[model samples]
Target: MRYDNFPDHSAALPEVTSTWSYHRRSSRRGAEEINDESAVSSEGEKEFLKVKKRKHKKIRATSQENHHWWYAFAVVTLLAVATRQVGLDLPAGTVWDEVHFGTFANHYINRTFYHDVHPPLGKMMVAGAAWLTGYQATFEFAVGKDYTPDINFVGMRGVSL
Candidate 1:
């Protein structure tokens, strides 16, 4: 009875025997046998197919429910992105050193200013972004590319609202 003595060879037929297994064996064509003593399995193949399709299946929430969840998620994400961007943008124009540093950085890049009181790291960070986002960084920060400088207060409050 042990598989160690003889390999299961339904293939070779040299060691084939009349012995059979309790589990159903698929035919050479791979179709399973109809195990209906009441002649029901042969009656409706479509009925068997419908039952078989549902046998190992799981149910998920409908697309409408999923859509609601995703819609809420998208709204929340956009709100967060808008709020953070507005927070960074609320105070338009350069502050104290920023004005001088930004001007100095612009000049420095174009070979304009030397001799600094502080590090160029902060200026460099801002300058790098300005260079990337196109001209007009002298007014609004380079970070806000799509923003309107004229509607500063309204644009800022729009994101919060």
Candidate 2:
């Protein structure tokens, strides 16, 4: 049932006739308003609203930023190499537990069976270093004993670094 003489309040209140249409309360006027710009045709058909598109900004790194990264990398690499190489062979006969590792290396070089609590990779590396330096497994590697001139202790220790 449609009222032919319905109150002409369309200007003050929006005519909500479709389920798809909705109202939003305006902050300035404190009144409900239709957000979508919709229009009704003479046959009572509603037009679809147009959506706004958004724009995005692209970012790129400058040459100075890349140069700063390279400078930091070079400084770190120099410090690492310098720290490892400084005083690597100073008054070193058997520093710390080198006597045990040296004996293990000798065992590997002499092809003899010896048991160690640690893994064999480190001992094998030391043995390879000693073999490359022409070590004959002659030194006893006793604790606190000075390394002889015949032994290339620096080369053997270099394997660790």
Candidate 3:
């Protein structure tokens, strides 16, 4: 008998149906496929986190570079000020172009007319500084001549710088 009239053919043929391994194998394969998909998604998340961390590290490095540049600028500025201030009062008098510029400054304070080869703005600055510092604008400027102790040429030079 073929058992075609049976209401449940699997129930009547339990041994043959139970021995069929295709259903179990298909179920196991489906479970493995789900696991593989989940593993791939987790790995992708890990990679994305790593990339984000790398970007953060780059930002930190850039910030550190900016700090370094600011520190360098500060150091250079301090060194320049120290260098410029060194021996500022040693000469105690006019040197180099001071003879020309200083005379022009004096003339400016006295309101006297003068002609200059260079622009007058620099002389005006010197004259303004001298006037602010209580200089009477009577100091004679000659090359290699020492300034009097009463004159605060250092203060004037500081203002010019």
Candidate 4:
């Protein structure tokens, strides 16, 4: 059966512990984590809050510190160039396979060539390096000179490497 005048609805059951509103200063904050009324009364809760704030301060300090990555990048780039230069021209002197190829290259440049064993491309490649180095005396030196017994293992490898 229903009453006509503002049919009486049961009142909302009262909560045993009232919910509290927490003003979140940060958007990332979660819902009311502690019962505020009980939290303020305990000494342990105060110490907990202080510790949390100190950890947050440490995070802020690290975030605010300045760093220079460009200096690191510049140093690394310079080292790369130096390394390339050192390996580019080394031994100043004769090598093994360099002995063979360098000889053929010099021959072709002077038009006094041995019939190349491989393809025309092979002889052409040798002649190309001679042309690139401007038929320099060093090209002849690499082919003709007997090494003076230094580790100059790097001598011929220098041109290619």
Lowest summed lDDT window (length 10), candidate 4: 18-27
Per-residue C-alpha lDDT of model 2 across residues 62-111, encoded as one tens digit per residue: 98887998999999999997787777688666887678878988898899
lDDT of 4 by residue, 1-161 (tens): 55587745556655232212122422245654443445554465555555655666743335434345667788999997667667533444454456666677667667673875666665456556556645542444454355444323333343454
| lDDT, residue 161, model 3 | 53
Error of 1 at 151 (Å): 14
Candidate 1 vs candidate 4: which has greater TM-score?
4
Q: Which of 1 and 4 is the better model by lDDT?
A: 4
**TM-score of each candidate?**
0.31, 0.55, 0.55, 0.33
Q: How many collisions per candidate?
A: 1, 0, 0, 0
Q: Count clashing pairs, candidate 3.
A: 0
Taking the tens digit of each residue's C-alpha lDDT, what string does model 1 give over 23-110? 2342336766444434332325435544655774898898888799889999999988766665555455444444454565466556
- What lDDT score is found at residue 94 in candidate 2? 84
> Each candidate: what lDDT?
0.51, 0.72, 0.71, 0.52
* Whole-model lDDT, model 2: 0.72
Looking at model 4, residue 111 earns an lDDT score of 69
Q: Which runs of model 1 end up more than 4 angstroms from their true locations? A: 1-84, 136-161
Superposition TM-score, candidate 1 onto the true structure: 0.31
